[model samples]
Target: MNWNSPIPLQAQTLNSLPSIMESHEPLLSLKQYSPEIEVYPAYYREGLSGAIDDCLLRHGVAQRLKKAAELLPAGIRLVLLDGYRPIAVQQALYDRQRNHLLEQGWTESEEMYAELHRFVARPTVDPAKPPRHFTGGAVDLTLTGPNGWLNMGTPFDDFSERAATRYYEQKSDLQPDEQLIRDHRRLLYHVMNQVGFTNYSDEWWHFDFGNQAWAILTGNERACYGGVVPQASN
Candidate 1:
């Protein structure tokens, strides 16, 4: 089967979109939501600063995630990696990625920032333009089967071109492994999209709902969810 790519969201697009009315949806804990959801907090596991051990998302986003999990093929479980990141965690991730890029020979200039922004959003405190994870409406996830995590071409947080959602689909004469990767990516993308989540084109495991990115990609006039910090009760 053939798959089309989603348009990547730009800072300009997110900045221009206004939230007609802000949503005050409480963040819900994914760990308490379902057994099928494997809430593995990636940043926390890596010991990133301010990272929470449990995954959380906006109330509505959690509902959609449950629906998406139910829609996945039998024996496949959704692995929720990261969600509702604090500014500290976001800053840690951004700084780490920037340093990695620099070590990879990326110069400190507009060109490096353009590439860095593809995988990590610059840390921000502005409510109108919060980082994706800061809104509690974006999620990083992949699929795991009876055997284990399905190969989705690239691992979560992979900042290479192969990490693109449709990378394998765009290639020709794929090897068996590559073909499996493509199928897995397609399944993950379609299942989440079917439940109203918008997949981030730069990363197969990333998806958004009710946030600025989602609103921009889905043509919604206003974003419902904005930057929000998750409470302990969440």
Candidate 2:
């Protein structure tokens, strides 16, 4: 259930769509999800959420985020970094990076695109679909305590092996700071799991709810949210 991409989609095995999310549910501002949880939009200075120009996600997603925030220890809060990426935004990012890679001598082939796809989804519209962020179901977030942001080892969107949710677990290092990072990752993981989310095991900051990844990890027979469809948060 952990990879650069979602799980259910990762497996060639597919599921039928659930009627509930055949279309996107209303998009809800992260602020409306809970004032206790902080919203830090990474891409939008003038996107959705008008005044703050933050991001939006399905209303069902907001409900789960509220539940997850409630489980945090006193003084610790959830800080969402990115959400509801416009497909145009996604394409711009993908094109920039892919062009950089190509400049470095990477070839244009399925092999190359697959490697690129691991981190950035191709911006084209196809029956296969786009990245989770485009669907408003995926989010990049971290924990912030009274002191400051907990050390997650790397910043959000690191796109490296060090960013792996279980990266520290795979090492034999006895460094105290290393252990601290591992513990922080687990705290976020456990709380999100409690609220029915599935982590992108490869990226500690990425988590999905009501998407194909959620269905595969939670064993739901069908996925709800498919693409960039989100209704207002009720």
Candidate 3:
């Protein structure tokens, strides 16, 4: 997939696939994805590790997370949901999503494109194109306190129009308590921005540190974590 094309999400579908029937196979499969829930060897704290796990963020991100944790009152800690996903894992997620749409009778070119755009950015095309996880600069996290997980306005990996900024603005019939959720969401964004991390906008739980996107936006020449994988000495 030529992901660099400037075509809009809707256009990508019209130009690429001729018919939905021809591209019936799911974009990726579940068996192909693996979650690397590795504990950072450096931050070896016992209970703290339970709340936090290493993700795609830079090597220095653990320290930054530790600093962020300090801002929280007692009993609240950052729960690292996922980090440092391999390119293969990303491909799997994309494929799984595509496959889901196909199963739902959205086997049309336009439908598939629209379905995908809801969760992923259109320009990026395939999950492995820019390989955000390979850069080790993006992390998926949430807040966890003594009461368990704090409501951050939305659920993790929620693929819905309701997950938007305006969603929090409108009072929902299902979720009647909007004020509390909105306040917590604002706090999460505030602390993350304080530490120089940028949210992905679409996902409240998603944050990026050192990457081309971060450097380009911040006007930094060098990013904190590149594509290099550190090797252990014998």
**lDDT of each residue in 39-103, candidate 2, tens digit only:** 98865643423223675877888888889898878998899887777767887768867887798
- Of the candidates numbered 1 and 2, which has the greater lDDT value? 1
How many pairs collide in each candidate, listed in order?
0, 8, 7
**lDDT ranking of the models:** 1, 2, 3
TM-score of each: 0.91, 0.82, 0.63
Which candidate would rank higher by lDDT, 2 or 3?
Answer: 2
Model 2 stretches with alpha carbons more than 4 Å out: 1-24, 45-52, 103-105, 126-128, 229-234
Give me candidate 1's TM-score against the actual structure: 0.91
Q: How accurate is candidate 1 locally (lDDT)?
A: 0.85
In model 3, state the lDDT of residue 212.
51
RMSD of 3: 12.7
Candidate 2: what lDDT?
Answer: 0.74
The C-alpha stretches of model 1 lying farther than 4 A from their native spots are: 1-15, 230-234
Better of 2 and 3 by TM-score: 2
lDDT of 1 by residue, 1-234 (tens): 122343223333454765635789898889997767998998889988888889989999999999999887689999999989888889999999999998999889999999989889999988768889999999999989999988888778988899987788778899999888888888888788888999888788999999988998878988898888645784
